[model samples]
Each structure stands twice: as structure tokens, then as C-alpha cells.
Target: MAARIEIEGDRCIGAAQCVLSADKLFDQDEDGFVVVLNGEPDGEDLEDARTAAMICPSQSITVVED
Candidate 1:
């Protein structure tokens, strides 16, 4: 199954771990909060997405199974 990304904006603390782990699927807004770049990415991207969620400092990154 592919993974889908979800971010809780209020919980984000401008940490870039998500962006650094999976830049193709995550980015930061002007306020430095997380922004979902690709909601659903398959294959290796899915793995990276999970990594992003794991490394997130604020625990705002959620990788949903699809």
C-alpha cells in the first residue's frame, strides 16, 4: 500500500526534519510550518514519507496507509 501524508499545522514548530527527510513530499510555508507537497507517493517515496514522520520533532507529520 502507498502512504499518504498529513500534517497538523498547529502542532508544527518550524522543524525541517520532515522537509529534510522527504523534501519531495514535504516543505515549509512562509511561517516555517510544514506543508504537504505530495499527499500520496508510492514506492521508495512512501518509505521516505514514513521517515519524515518519524524524524519530525513536533510529531506533526502523519503518514497514513492507503
Candidate 2:
């Protein structure tokens, strides 16, 4: 199973920390806000996704086990 990823738009402060940490699972929108490229992260990506969540300056990233 993969992990469910979520990003709170309002909480995002245009920081690309998540992107830097997990480019495979995250990206930035036109506005520079963080976006979840993959809602369900694979086993290997799951760790990166979780790291992205912690690396997020605005704490906008969320990973839920599905």
C-alpha cells in the first residue's frame, strides 16, 4: 500500500523544502506553493514523503497510511 499525501494550500508559504526533499512526491505550483504530485507514495517514496512533511517550513505536508 501507498501513503496518502496532503498539502494544506493556505499553510504553504512558497517554500520548496518539500520539493527538495521529495521531488518525486511533491512539487510547487505557479504560486510557489507546495503540491502533492503523488497522492499515494510507493514504499521507497513513503520515507521521502515523510521527510518532506517534516522538512516543510509551513508544516503543510501530511502523510496518511491508506
Candidate 3:
């Protein structure tokens, strides 16, 4: 399955947990909020991306199967 990661800017609180959990997939913006560096991460990185999304405190990260 192909996975896509999306971040809800409105819900993000600059916790940086997503980036901390999965740096390859997530990056911190000037405001410290998370941004999806590579929306589509592959192989083992994909699992980490999903884990980051699932662990987000703000529930701002979303992972979709395509």
C-alpha cells in the first residue's frame, strides 16, 4: 500500500513530537509546528511516519493509504 502523510496546521501546537518521532517524514517550521517533508515515505520509513501520526498529541497528523 502507498501511504500519504498530511498535517493539519490549525490543530498543530508546535510540540514537535512528530519530527522527534520521525525526522525523515516530518520537519519543524519556524513556529515549531510539524510539516511533512516527504508526504510519501517508503519501506521502513513509512512505518515510522505512521507511528508519528498516531502519536501526535494534537492529532494533527494523518496517514492515508492509496
Candidate 4:
């Protein structure tokens, strides 16, 4: 099963850190909030995505295995 990342919109503080950490899997909206570019990141990009979730200041990111 592939691992997936989920964002809690309410918990997000509009921090773009996730996007900065993993551009391939994350992007910021015009408001500077992060949104998942791809829920299923593969290869090295997946590692970056996981790191981004772990380092998120607001703890808004959730990683799940399916």
C-alpha cells in the first residue's frame, strides 16, 4: 500500500514551509497556504513530502499508509 499525506485545513496556518520542503508534492495558494500537489508522492519526492509533514510548524499534515 502507498503512503498518503493529508492536510488539515483548519490547523494549517497558511505556512508555506511544506511547499518549500517538497515542491513536487506541495504548493501554496495565493493566500500563502499549502495544498497538496499530489497525495501519492513517489521516489525521492515521497521522502521530501514526509519530511515536510513532520516539520510542519502547525502540525497540520497527516501521513497515512494505505
TM-score of each: 0.92, 0.90, 0.92, 0.87
**Cα deviation of 14 in candidate 2 (Å)?**
1.1
Per-residue alpha-carbon lDDT of model 1 for 1-66, expressed as tens digits?
866788888999997998888889888999989988899989989999889889888899888895
lDDT for 50 in candidate 2 is 86
Q: Evaluate model 2: give its lDDT.
A: 0.85
Predicted candidate 3, C-alpha RMSD: 0.8
Which pairs of residues collide in model 3?
none
Clash counts for all predictions: 0, 0, 0, 0
Off by over 4 Å in 3: none
lDDT of 2 by residue, 2-66 (tens): 56988788999987998888898888888888878888887889999889888888888898886
On residues 1-46, what C-alpha lDDT tens digit does candidate 4 reach at each position?
Answer: 5888888988889778898888888888887887888998777877
Q: Rate the local accuracy (lDDT) of all candidates.
A: 0.88, 0.85, 0.87, 0.84
The ten-residue window of minimal lDDT in model 3 covers 28-37
Clashing pairs in 1: none
Q: Write the per-residue lDDT of candidate 3 for residues 1-66, one digit (tens) a residue.
A: 888888789999988888888888888888887878899888988989888988899999998888
List of clashing residue pairs for candidate 2: none
lDDT agreement of model 1 with the native: 0.88
